[model samples]
Target chain A: MSLKNILSEKKDELLASWFDRILDTYPVETAKFLKNQKDRFANPVGQAIHKGIGDIFQELLQNGDIEKVSGFLDSIIRVRAVQEFSASQAVAFIFFLKSVIRDGLADISLTPELYDELATLESQIDSLALIAFDIFMQCREKLYDIKANEMKNMTYRLLQRANMVTEIKDAEKETNFIAIHKKEVNS
Target chain B: MAKLPKPEELLQINYNPPPTEDWMDRPVELKQGNFCWGAKGKNLAAVEFPNARDWTPVEADWKLPKDWEGTVLEAMADRLSKYRSFKVFMDICVRCGACADKCHFFIGGGDPKNMPVLRAELMRSVYRKYFTTAGKYLGKLAGARELDLNVLKEWWYYFYQCTECRRCSVFCPYGIDTAEITLMAREFTNLLGLNTDWISGPVANCYMKGNHLGLEPHAIMNSIEGMIDDIETITGIRINPSFNRKGAEILFVTPSGDLFADPGTFTAMGYMMLFHELGIDYTWSTYASEGGNFGFFTSNEMAKRLNAKIYAEAKRLGVKYIIGGECGHMWRVLNQYMDTWNGPADFMEVPKSPITGTVFDNAASTKMIHVTEFTADLIKNNKIKLDPSRNDDLVITYHDSCNTARGMGLLEEPRYIINSVCNKFHEMPDNTIRERTFCCGSGTGLNASENMEIRMRGGYPRANAVKFVRDKHGVNMLANICAIDRATLSASMDYWVPGVRVTGVHELVANALIMTGEKERETNLRGEPLPGKGGNE
Candidate 1:
């Protein structure tokens, strides 16, 4: 059988292992709760991660574009971005799939072409990790932007109320207005 | 590059928490972005808090008072005797894990310590060690430990992390209110002068100047004067509002946030426009300027001290009753704690709506009615006309502020008002609304900028629900009655679900309110052009 066929057959088993590894990063108690809870509204993080993993796996199998894959990654990364994970730790879950794919497909016959195909799949995941890092940084930057804007917004109305803010006149508008007024008077 | 590990070896990363060591032995790490700045000595001294001094949580030495442990234990013992609820809560948790996943912090961040049962156990452990006979002898076996400095620091970090939203208490089989435990823990911390600057500064301001923003009498007028001008520009009807005027039938008190912030300012305008449309006899007081009490976050004594001004001002102004504006914890205090702390408000009478002759017998004892209840009554009586089409630009969703939903049972009044004023309204998932509502996550004065990361963590569940509605209903505006929700949820929405704006419920009312002798309003109270009004959209 072809390497793609063998890997596709083991997809469900591999995906479950990869998902379990991702949950393993959380505390044992929290991991158990995340596994047991089924409701999306009640367990949002777990639901996102589970749904994201399945979609991401399908995209990988279809050799989907990185842009399509990123949408899946965002669903998971957005939750992890605010969680207690450093940037490295946050993106590290993507790397677990590499080992899971290799370990799950161990029983297949070792053809040279299969080795090349496996390496290509591994490279795809490596590139995915890079995309995830970018997504993670975008989420982090958005958080910082929100924080700075909050400080400004909290005092904005108060400053306006106190008359602490003054409108800075546009110099170009001033010159145009002066020209228009002077012409009108001369005419 | 160095040689990479084999696949089997690579899977053995220590990123997973070790299973061997128990969570109890994991030393507390006071991470940056997880905690707020400590209360300044001057701010604490302004309120005359015991052991007033400068302190920071990150520092090795907290500069605690000599024999601080003895002080805390004595205070705990005293409180154990004083509040029967405290004693029962300390004793009654069965740890059925019912509340473990319910906490927003735990659900979002996955920090085991954020679990409500475990968070309570941080205090319950100390309570067990010092107070219970089994814990005193058995120690670790009985789930108790010594109240050392590490334990004290853990208490400081975890107690403040709680917003006291009481979502966990809903799931607890024993009816254990974990928020009261957090309140008790905070009260103990305040005894050691350990308080957050976000909370202590407001407490000091409220104590000295009668408002959280420290706006003096003239400044309050100045701010309201700005709103009055905006009201005139929008409606072409200048509202002549009274300040500290005697013989006004109702005294209006709201959180100073409404007078000082963007969306909250708009809500304040809504109140004025609504009152003017109905032509109610109401007055604002500079003496009791703030409705939300930050002192409630500090200690019971301080909360009582801050709450006393409202009744005193009512007597001074000779208003028959009080009408509180849109706020969250303020209503919680009014509904639960106000009458107990400073009661027998015999000077005031039950609020009766002059427009519809509806008597608020529910507020007969407190003599203070919520603005939503009053407005909902008016709408039910068909006394006011609201053009819901004016709010066509907004696909609105209601976020029940934790204090209002869980603290006070204020679920339907705001919804009734929202339905009366807006064309589009959608409720978030059933579990995430009403009594099971998640906090805006920055309540009880944890909304400081330094703790933005943790605030976002705590806010994740709430933002998740909003994201659900935004995806399902194209929800663009998050309407709430809480002032802090107006302030903090804006940042949270900006972070978690961009393009979603936050507003006070009354802001929507003001946008849809049609007043007699008013010009065509090209813009809403926010000065943003209404849908089909501004040409650009």
Candidate 2:
């Protein structure tokens, strides 16, 4: 079957699996908040998901008809990462959506056999969510470490500079012409 | 021999108190005028001087160089740069006037010019007009007044009035220290060779000779020997305080004035006794013996050079750490400048005081541990046996020296030591204690006879506080750390309030300690036994 037909038949199952994989990482309250918010997902979240899923498909298959949907899902995770939402929080949010998607799929009167097929599709989404969460955490840690080291290095330098000036001052009672000259320039 | 008139009679010059009741009611601008001239319409020419012949302007002028005119502006600029911190502080002050009522001089003299902010403004206004861009262009618009001969004369008068005690900075929200301004002004005046002979002569002598009081190495040795003799008489401990001893664990640096003067030299002996009792290996370095930084009054380079000797001596002796003696500006310079300019001392260890076991962090930056702090910690930790009962009848009150209190935030250590050593410890009013403390009114080498009226006015508030304690609580003694405060307060107490004695905090601590061959130490003004006297067992 064509990729478009496959995705259309298994879209609900794919979303549900992705959601379940993300939910396992956060606390129960955050998982619940994400689930509730997903029920009424607004323009920003919808647009991000659409763009991300499209990009993912473009990279995965050059001529795949299912590229738009894959890019949309990819965009959702990438946008959430930049917002400083913790990896755990993002996972919990995806889990809530998975539970909602499961219920929605069940309400559609699909057969048990069809549901089994959908479960296979959901596993692919789960793998995608896990990979995105790992990348987000690694980037955040690197950024924080850089900032901390910069501050420490700056303080150490200032202390050294101050010490040099003090030594020159202590050596004699006469005015240090060098310090005086420097002072004139700075003023 | 006729006994000298009571300390009170010695300070009794014809001082007309400024109008106090009308002070708060008058406009701020009018108060500025009152500051410039002590009383309304009191001309500088009309002001009487009882001891004029020695300190007259003519005598001062005669001492100046032929090219003194060229050096005046150079000196002022040099001073402005030397105490660049002061210039930064002046520009930064928001004029909240929180430090207005805080100055003891302003409160006592009833002169608004004596107000820490106004006194600082006298130089700051001139600084703005001459140095800054906005002030140069906008002039009056920027509140920058031009520097003229009259302005120079006013600078000489009002700047001298300030003791550079830094009491105002404590209450200042932005830490706008006025002592920096006073030092800068003095530096400017000194550059023109227009210095009070009392201070400049000594400063020049210290520059040429190694000591402020012109004490030669032999004189210093003899002075220390004499102190050892006095200590032997008091406590029966015959200690030969080793000077310039190599490889000592610690190097003790003190003001040279202390080695020759009364009560101060006595206090020095007390430090020696404590060091001996503690069994700490410490030596006094004659080269760095003078801890008082007079260069702080004149030039930054001079200040640096003056301070350099101590570190140089410390390096030479290979001492583990250097300990400053009980002096004000010495601590300030040490606390603020020493570490920054002369450090990364790989050889000398950061001072881990043996008595307190408190490892001093930032020894180069706000890292100073005053002698009183060490003593207090030792007492608290039970390392030293102190008998408080020996100080009976000593109604002791502590006057926080501006340099120590405002510049260093050393409010509690001295008090903690005093309370631990003496039983009858009373605090002055809330306005005159701790961070809000007043100057002894004769700091920054202003203890000269020429600046008597200014000194008296500056010392007024502090004296009033002392008087308040005397009248209310029968307090008869003032304990302080700064040596200048001791001298200024001694003169002020003698003149303004009788029967009040001032001593270094360490003197009392030394008295309280259980020294060898002395079961009980003498009581101070209060009637309590000194610490370690008649205590348990």
DockQ of each: 0.55, 0.00
lDDT of 1 by residue, A1-187 (tens): 7667887898889888988999998988889888889888788889899999899988988976788899999989988887777787888899999889888978766789989988988888999999999999999998888778777766665565556564455686673211111123234
- lDDT string, candidate 2, B408-443, tens digits: 788887888888888899998877777767778777
Point to the candidate with the largest lDDT. 1
In model 1, how large is the Cα lDDT of residue B306? 97
What is every candidate's alpha-carbon RMSD to the true fold? Answer: 4.7, 29.1
Tens-digit per-residue lDDT, A1-187, candidate 2: 4333554566556554544444333233223333443311112233334334435434333342344434444345433443324455543443344454565566466566666655654554466556656655644443344334434433432333333222245456665423312334344
> Candidate 1 DockQ category?
medium
Q: Interface root mean square deviation of every model, in Å?
A: 1.8, 33.0
Off by over 4 Å in 2: A1-187, B1-96, B131-142, B362-368, B517-537
lDDT of 1 by residue, B1-537 (tens): 999889999656566656736767988989888899999999999989987788888899888898999999999999999999999999998889999999988888888889999999999998999999999999989999988888888999988899989999999999999989999999998998999899999999999999998999988999899899999998899999999999999999999999988788999999999999989899999989999999989888999999999999999989999999989889889989888888879888988999999999999999999999999999999988889999998999999989888887989999999998998999999999999999988998998988888898889889999999999999999999999999899989988898899999888988998999999989999787888887726
Off by over 4 Å in 1: A169-187, B1-14, B18-20
Pairs clashing within candidate 1: none
CA error at residue A51 for candidate 1, angstroms: 1.0
